[model samples]
Target: MTRIFSALVIGLIFGAGIALSGMANPAKVLNFFDVAGSWDPSLAFVMGGALVVTAIGYTFVLKRKAPVFDRLFHLPTRRDIDRPLLAGSAVFGIGWGITGFCPGGAIPALGLGYSDAWVFVGSMVAGIALARLARHTMAARAAGKAV
Candidate 1:
């Protein structure tokens, strides 16, 4: 219950930050990507500020024995740069560049009632579903081969 409450509070804070920072605007995001044209550096500042805050927070938080909400930190252990990672990254970049909306931005942008945001979010869900299906299919094939 405590963990759930904490997560809810944290998520709300994050959403509020996104909304306040003007990151929910697709035009701002698109402008950031327009390097050859009028490239907006505002997103870079926001990202830098976020990175700095995260760095400072992580530095302090990691000094503790364990996370407040979890028994373990649950950090990712994989360090290898593999094909799926590369492919997924490329797809994500392409989608973001074209639509000016990543999943994080798009989800909040829906509050503004933009058609592009709606379409982006819908497509994002479909992509996630397809990825899950592909994973399941691959696992089944692997299991069959092992038998």
Candidate 2:
């Protein structure tokens, strides 16, 4: 229950940050990709600032044995570049390029009363469901083969 509340509070802070940053505007994000026409470098600055802050946070957080809310520090174990990773990255890049609404930004953009965010979020949810189903089917096949 505490963990859930902490997550909710953190998520709200993240959403508020996104909203305040003007990143909730798809046009602002899309313009960052348009190097030939009306390119905006503000996104790059924002990314750099985030990177700096994250680096500082990581420096402090990693020094701790465990997280404040959790007993263990949850981190990615996989380091190797695999087919699934590459495919997922490509898909993510394509989606971002086309829609300019990332999962993080899209959630906050919902508060702006834009139908575009709704469509993107709905599609994202469908994609996530399909991915989970496919992964489950693949795992079942692998297990059956092993038997």
Candidate 3:
């Protein structure tokens, strides 16, 4: 299908960009966080460039009636900063600071055969699974049912 193919192509391009930008390397990303030691500012420039591109792209893309693959644009509807959002943000920041692998970069880093990538990706999957399970259990409890 066109949708599936488009997604595949887009993902490949994104992965290539992450790799080419050195964002897939844990050491590089970690160094970016390091201020007193071997600090790197290239990643910051890369992020700034990405932000600019995204801003420009959004300006043009949002004007379109709908996405090429979908009848409606699937954007986040929530704007409130709730407890779960804060908790999740903290978790994500801690993980990134410690491992230097955001979800987007980690996936592409897998192709580089890095051990850190494997560990990060594994932990990310486990975390997601645990979150889903916890949500389901909590929902069941709220309904006065055994999970």
Candidate 4:
């Protein structure tokens, strides 16, 4: 119950930050992407602010032996830059360029009840499902060959 409450509070704070920073506005994001048109560079400052805060938070977290809630930090052990990572990143970039809505911004934009936001969210979900299915099929094929 405490963990759930903490998570809810964190999510609310994050959403409020996104909203207050104007990141929830699709037009702002689209304008940022439109370097050839009336481009807006405000998002760059928002991203930089986020990066600085994240860096400070991570620095403090790493200094602790254990997290306040979790038993361990459970950080990713894999550091290799492989094919799947590259392919996925490329696909994500293409989608972002076409839609101007990354998953985080998409959800908030959808909350504003825009038809385009709904369409983007639907396509984003479909892409995620397709990626998961492809990964599952590849794993199954690998297992079958090993048997």
In terms of lDDT, the best-performing candidate is 3
Query: Candidate 4: where is the Cα deviation over 4 Å?
Result: 145-147
| CA RMSD of each candidate after superposition | 2.0, 2.1, 1.0, 2.1
Q: What would the TM-scores of all predictions be?
A: 0.91, 0.92, 0.95, 0.90
Q: Which clashing pairs does model 3 show?
A: none
As a TM-score, model 1 comes out at: 0.91
**lDDT tens readout by residue for model 2, 30-128:** 999999999999889888988999999999999999999879999999899999999999998899889999998999999878689999999999999
Please give the range of 10 consecutive residues that has the lowest summed lDDT in model 2. 138-147
Model 3 C-alpha lDDT per residue in residues 12-76, reported as the tens digit of each score: 99999999999999899999999999999999999999999999999999999998878999999
User: How far out, in Å, is residue 66 in model 1?
Assistant: 1.0
* Each prediction's whole-model lDDT (CA): 0.88, 0.91, 0.94, 0.84
Q: Write the per-residue lDDT of candidate 1 for residues 1-147, one digit (tens) a residue.
A: 998999889877887788788888888998999999989999999899999999999999999899987797988999999999999999999998888898878877888677899988888999999999888889989889541
Candidate 3, 146: how far from true, in Å?
A: 1.3
Off by over 4 Å in 1: 145-147
The superposed Cα distance between candidate 4 and the true structure at residue 38, in angstroms, equals: 0.8
Give the 10-residue window scoring lowest on summed lDDT in candidate 4.
106-115
Q: Which candidate leads the pack in TM-score?
A: 3
